[model samples]
Target: MEFWRYYRVIRRRRWLILLGTLAAVLMVVYWNYTTPTMYIGKTTLMEPKGQTQDGVPLFQSQMMGTMLDPQLQLSNLGNIATSQKVLSNAAQSLAELGLKMDPEDILAATSVHPERDTNILAIEVTLPDEQEAKVAADAIATEFKKTYDELNNQALKDSRNFIEGQINSTRNAMVKAQDALRRYKEQNGVVEINQQLADSVQNLYLAQTNANQAQINHEAAASRAMKAATELAKLPESQIAGTSISRNPIWERLSESLTDLETKKAAMLNGVPGQPRRGPNHPEVVALQAQINDVKDQLSKTKSDYIASTQQAKNPVWQTAYGNWFQAKVEDVATGAQAAAAENVIKKMKSEMSQLPAKEAELAKLQVDLKAATDTYSLMKSKLDEAKIRENQGSSEVALRTIDPAHVTEAHNNGLLKLALALVLAPLMGIGVAFLLHYTDNTVKTAADAEKLLGLPVLTAIPGSKAHSLPRQHCPEIMDVAYQMLTSNLWVATQNQADNGIVMVSAEPDAGRSVNASNLAVALAREGAKVILVDADLRKPTQHLIFGVDNKVGLTNVLSGGATLEDALALTRVQGLLLIPAGPVPDNPVKLLRSPEMKEFVDQVKEFADFVVFDTPAGVTFPDPVLVASQVGSAVVVHSAGRVPRGSEAELRQRLESIGVRLIGAVLNKVRREDSSSFFHYHRSYEGVVMPQLTSGKKAIKSGPRDQA
Candidate 1:
């Protein structure tokens, strides 16, 4: 999970990645060495520069004289170069030259690449023979040029024929339109009708002017009559009495009498200057007042009659005003009638002018047809002349000039590219496979593995020591530090337990359980503690060989009660350390290890020794290790780093836990110290000199308290 842990895996499996990469690259190299080489021929052709060939443009112009884009032209040329017709022609020419190559073969071996943004085509051909490659390339180029010229000539000829036919058809149409125009002019006797149409329009406008003047005059007359009539009708009856009321004789006579009587009444009421003026009913005053009342009554009646007669059109002044208004209305009606006649005349003239436009439209249509036909005929004739000139040019107008003739060269087998691909992919694949193996591998290799696999702390990591191979102890100080750490951790783990027995065992055989137990015993003994390492693996005991002790009498003899502890216990080369080797192979190591005598012996040894480490058989394969582990009551599982599978370690821890063995911790034994420094390798304090040494193969230690004791 950490970067360093992944780096460790890569470092450990670096050989595999290297081997895989080398193998892949070597395979590619071998293939390249064995593969056959091919010869390639190349030729280049430049595009036509739109130059004229004998008065004809190389790029033929259309009837409309429009030239194609250069890019489009180049694309068409490329297509023709690779076209089946050109390729087949090339094949046929080659066959004629005694080279019977199939068209498909030639096509397959040939490639046409048109340079982008440039009007150059590069043709390449690869074949077995160099000369054949050159010949094939040159032949294909020649055939392409020839086929393109032929196709271009055919297109030009088709264009000429089509243009000629169009020109003839247009000429005929132009002649017909001309004849129709002449006939129309003769039949209609119309040289120019615009002037006649203009004159008719002028006449209609003049009529409209006269009609407008008449309407103005009639409106003025009507307005004057209306004003006169309204003024006469609005006048008060008193103001019109002489003029308007005289028309009614009865009202005029009544008005005169009422005025005379009112004048006499006013004089009578005056009473001659100071008289009591008719205080009482004077006869003269009474008479005049009565006359005035009667006259007033008569005047009111006559005025009512006059007003009613005026409303009924009987008033003389109202009649005169009404007659004048009627006369004005008649004049207005007559003038409007004349204006309507003029409008009708104008409509007739407009109708005739609208017909003139039809004739003008006909004439314009004939003129347009004649002009279009003439233009088309002239254009087609010019295009036809160009086409004839091009045809006479002998297809040179569309011919291709070889910029560079075909040349032969050796074809690379693409080994360099293959090598490059291999070089790039091989390492990647190797790394992928390496990481795959690392992920799939379930072995316990580091302290993290111990914690992950068994949930146990790694008490110490004893790296692979040279002491195992040599008779003399020549291991680095890391080994000493590892054993010291192991013994110290064991003491700390078992400080609460009264029993001093600890069984060092592994999930499988040869997992450094014996070596770790012996080394830890020596380390403890060096601390001045009485340490005993008992080889309990009677099936395959290794402590006897490691400490150079006699296996003729050891744990087995003591457990069987055939010999006393003093006789079975052998002093090792390490001072203060005792070894009890597994005596001669037994018939039933499990029964022997499980005997009560074995427990008593372990208790007796614990009584004498400060610490006892029992080297038991592998717990996974043999039950003796489990029996010894149960009797010992304490366990230190020694797992060889990068060797023991975690699955087995987990299974062993589960079994030991289930059986009530006090598992102190696990020691990752035989850890290979990576050259890349780590915490374990940093303590190289013993690089200077040797302090003391342990003897191997039955030699008792000559130093330390062993000799003195």
Candidate 2:
């Protein structure tokens, strides 16, 4: 059902959608015809695998080869091929071929990319002329090759120069180191330091041994001298050889005289015992002692001159001890002098040994420096030789080979794709616009719309009439059923009201208000009720035309007191139905409808029929309908689908209710069948059953109503 409702909206605007799609297709066709045809020229090149153009290995090790990325190399080559220098050269080459172009233009027309999973590169150029495209491709490829070769040669030259510089620097360092070592050796006298150090160690050992031996010998000699001296001291210089006694006569006489003098001196000193005693200190005693001392001296002189007795023989043991002592002392002095001389030699040897290590260390350091410089110079010389070889070859590590020359072909066209896109998208755009207009359109298009807008129940949805140019009498059976439903719903709504009369009003003109009033009266009369449809719209009367009644004098005439109710009333062909036309348009319908006679006319009509439906003009245009509805006391809005704006209907309902007119409901007229809800499907189902009964009932009503009238 939802889809059907949308279908109805599209169906109504189908012509608009068709026109939009056609316009889009025409535009696409024009664009496709006017667009220029393009041609493409292509060329192919291959990158060398891990070697130079001269077949020299690019990498020295397998690890380096594995780390090499083909993609990264391709990217670098692509950048170089498209660089400014290459492009400028290519442009100049193109000019030589009679095609003047700028570098930017050539760049814009060219594309370079590497083929996937391969070492192949593709270069393409696109232009309007096939020959021009081919020429441009060739020029670009030639220039790129020349530039790449030049760059490779220049790189090789730079590598060779660098290696040469390193070799020269290393040679200089080696020479300096050699000179420094020679100077150091000459300054320190460090010729064969290892051998010299060994010799010094041996000599120091011999000197130490000699010093120790001499010291021992000196101590032994000194001990022997001490023993000899002790023995010599104990033995005297000469032993007492023999004891001798001899006396001279003169010595004996002198001894006797000396003894007599001594006896006289003693007597004088003691004083004679018998003669007068004399003091020893007396003169006579002193003189006598002096004479005795003189005599004793004379006796000693005589004893000395006269020898006593002597033995003259040397001691052999004493003489031997003295000689041994003298020999030991001389040996001790000689040993001591030898020990001192040996000590001086050991000290000199030790001093020389201690200095040998420092000289050895210095010599070792200078030798190490010279060896390092020589090794470095050798390595650099080898590298320089290799660089010179590479420079002579004059090629880069990654080489290029032309696989295919430039060739031209037609470029792919997308005209059909554009047409297909237009076909698909044009309809979508039209649909979007249709929905936009549908949603923005404020008019009531369905029964639900009418009900929701007016806040009233929808009485019925009348199918659009097939013969809208004809009278209501020629309308289809579906319309008749719709009117019947409206009458029944209105009847139920007004059953408890004091007045059974209702005013039929619309928000706008051409809403089928008069037609709905006429049909509703006919449907009510067919149900065996007396019905009267009064054309209260004096401003724009449509009921007379719908019912084909005379309208010379009707509601306006009665309201203006120009005609009587009996004179204005006319019978319709519908059984039990009556008509009162608008009865000539009045200049001022509002004043007439607002008069006191309008109420009386309404009361008299209510008493004469079961229902009195008053058809009024559009409420939004004139106040005539509001005035009439105010008198009728009840109203039913008749709205053509998508004809009357919702706001107008709401305003009309407000006006009627404000004037005390009860709004029964609204009728959604002229609704398309597809827009109707599922409830209307029952009408289609029971069409066969209801059509016969309706025909027979109409026959009965026509016959019976004619006889009674």
Off by over 4 Å in 2: 1-38, 49-69, 72-111, 143-399, 414-443, 464-466, 469-477, 494-498, 508-510, 518-531, 544-552, 570-578, 583-587, 643-646, 678-709
TM-score of each: 0.57, 0.56
User: lDDT by residue for model 1 over 53-127, one digit each (tens)?
Assistant: 222232222111225556767787878888889889899888898889988899899988888877788899999
Q: Residue 639 in model 2: shift from native, Å?
A: 3.3
Per-residue lDDT over 555-612 for candidate 2, one digit per residue giving the tens place of the 0 to 100 score: 7788888988777877777767778888888888778888888877877778777788
Q: Best candidate, lDDT-wise?
A: 2
List per-prediction Cα lDDT, in the order shown. 0.71, 0.74
Screening candidate 1 with a backbone cut-off below 3 angstroms (N, C-alpha, C), the clashing residue pairs are 548-698
Q: What value does the lDDT take at residue 85 in candidate 1?
A: 91
